[model samples]
Structures are given as C-alpha cells and as structure tokens.
Target: MLKNSLDCIEETGKGDISIWLTRGNEEDNFNYLNIMDTAKGIYPKQAEKIFESFYSDRKGGTGVGLAYCKMLMKTAGGDIYCKGKFNQFAHFILKFPKID
Candidate 1:
C-alpha cells in the first residue's frame, strides 16, 4: 500500500501524501490506516476495480500489488478500500482488527 502511494506521488510529480491511524469503536475492534494522496486520482469506475487481480492502467504495471495486498489483509482479518476522483486525490483505507 505504501508502494502504491509512492507510485501515485511519483506519477503526479507534485502532490502530498498523508497517513492517518485511528482506533475503531469497541464493536468494530479494528484499527484504521488511511493513506491519502493529492495526485491524479482514478475515476469512480476504477475505484473498486483497481483491487481486481492483474488490473493496471499504467504502463509496465502488473496490477498485482493491490490485489495481493487485499488478499493478505483479508487473510489477516482485515480489508482494504479506495476512494478518490480523477485529477483530485486518492484515499486508501485499510482496516485491521485489534488483537486480544
């Protein structure tokens, strides 16, 4: 996920990236890591599709990075999501449950 954010920043050539960590409610029992980047973001249609395997819009991009990350997160009882707009910004949220 960090790599993806770095790539987005590199692609934009001029933007900022911010990270936020927060704790979820007691019912949720999860910790959230939000990575937001001020870059050329993706379209709404691409938001969910970006997590699909082998889906990349960039040259020489295999698109496996995000898919793999999602798989790993799920395996660890977590999940990942993305939200953003074209030429605006991209925000990725990763949620992991707290360990007892």
Candidate 2:
C-alpha cells in the first residue's frame, strides 16, 4: 500500500498523501484503511483496469504491485479498491472484516 501511494506521489509530484483508519458501513461489516493522494488522479477507466496483471502505464513498471495487493487482500478475507477523479485525487481503500 505504501509502495502504491509513493508511486502516486512521485508520479504526480503535486500534492501530499494521507492515510487513516475508518469504519465501513454497518451492513458492510468491515473496517477500512484509506490512503488518499491529492495528486493528479487516473481516469475512471484506468482505475477499473489497474488491478489487472501487467496493466501499468508507467514506463518500466511491471504492473504487478496492485494486482498482488488485491490478491493478498482477498487471501486474508479483505479487499482493496480505488476511487478518485482525473487530475483531482486518488483514494485507495483497504477493507478488513471486523473481529469480535
């Protein structure tokens, strides 16, 4: 997650990143760690495609980072996703089930 955030920071070089913990919807039954970058964001189309293997736009990028993250999150019974607008911000949310 930090790697992905740092990549966004370096890619845009415009604004800083913030990370915090938050609870999900009651029905959702999970907690979340949100990492948001104020730098320029990707298009919605690109965002949808980012988790696919070898789907990077960065030069020399292997495009394995996000794909791996998604896999790992699923393995742990959690999930990761992104939200943002082009040239505005990038928000990455990692969600985990609540433990009693």
Candidate 3:
C-alpha cells in the first residue's frame, strides 16, 4: 500500500503519505493504524472493489496486495477498510483487536 501510494504521487511532482497508529478506545478493544495519501484518490465504488481478488487497474499489478491484507487481518480477528473521494485523498484504516 505504501508503495502504491508513492507511485500515485509521482506524477504530481509532490504529495503526502501519512501513517498514524493509536490505541483505540477501551470500549472498542482495538488498536488502529491509518494510512492516508494525498494523491489521485479513488471513487467510493472503486474503493470497495479494490479488495476483491484479481481486481487491478494498474499495469503489471497482480492485484493481490489489498485482498491479501484483508485476509490476514481477518485471520487475526481484525478488520481493514478504505475510504476516499476523487482527487482528494485515500485512507485505509486497519483495526487490530486486542487479545484477551
């Protein structure tokens, strides 16, 4: 995902990729990591579809990256999601639930 973000910003001369990690609220019992990039953002529909297997819009892209991440998170009893708007930003939130 970081590599993809870096590639997305290359055409514009400059852009930003930010990552933040935080302990989620006690009620949630999760830790959170956010990866946000200022680049050519994705449409709402596209964002949802990106996690599907074999979904790729990039040349030479195997398209398994995001889908694999989702699978790993689920296996760990966590979750992942993406949200963004066109020409604005792309944000991916990963939720890691705390073990008992």
Candidate 4:
C-alpha cells in the first residue's frame, strides 16, 4: 500500500500518505487501520474495480496489489474496502471482526 501511494507521489509530485491504526472495540466490530493517500485518487466507479485482480491503469502494473490485500484480509476474518474521490484521494479501510 505504501508502495502504491509512493508511486503515486512519484508520478504526480503530490506526497501524502496517512496511516492510522486503532484498537478494535470489544463491543463492536471495528476497523483497525486506515490508509489514505493524496495520490491520483480513484473515481467512485473504480473503487470496487480496484480490488479486482489484473485490473490496473498504470503501465507495467500487474494490478494484483489490492486484490491480494482483500484476499488476505478476508482470510484473516477481516474486510477491506476503498473509498475515494476522482483526482483527489483514496482511502482504504480495514475492518476486523470483534473477538471475544
């Protein structure tokens, strides 16, 4: 994820990747991390598509990064999703299920 954000900065001359982590709430299903980047953000329509394997716009980009991340999170009983605005920023939130 950092690489993706860094690449965006490298390509666009905009550099801002904010990573925030939080503890899961015992009484509620919670998100533990947020990765927001000021890179060339995704359009609302592309948000879902970004998680698809082999989907990429950049040259030589295999497009497996986010897809892999989604799979990994699911396997660990968590969920991953992206929220972003076109030409603005992309925010990735990772939610982990509550544990006893």
- TM-scores for all predictions: 0.92, 0.88, 0.92, 0.87
Tens-digit lDDT track of model 1 for 1-100:
6777788789778778899999998788899999988877778789989999999998899999999989999999999999999888888999998998
Which candidate, 3 or 4, has the higher TM-score? 3
Clashing pairs in 1: none
**Every candidate's lDDT:** 0.88, 0.84, 0.90, 0.87
lDDT of 3 at 83: 97
**Structure candidate 3, residue pairs in collision:** none
Cα-based lDDT at residue 24, candidate 1: 91
Candidate 3 structure quality by residue, lDDT tens digits, 1-100: 8998998899665669999998977788999999999888879999999999999998788989999999999999999999999798999999999767
- Model 1 scores worst on lDDT over the 10 consecutive residues at 1-10
> Which TM-score value belongs to model 2?
0.88
The predictions' CA RMSDs to the true structure, in order, are 1.2, 1.5, 1.3, 1.8
Task: Count backbone overlaps in model 3.
Answer: 0
lDDT order of candidates, best first? 3, 1, 4, 2
- Which pairs clash inside model 4? none
Span of 10 residues, lowest total lDDT, candidate 4:
23-32
Give the better candidate number (1 or 4) by TM-score: 1
| Clash pairs (backbone) in predicted model 2 | none
- What is the RMSD, in Å, between candidate 2 and the native fold over all Cα? 1.5
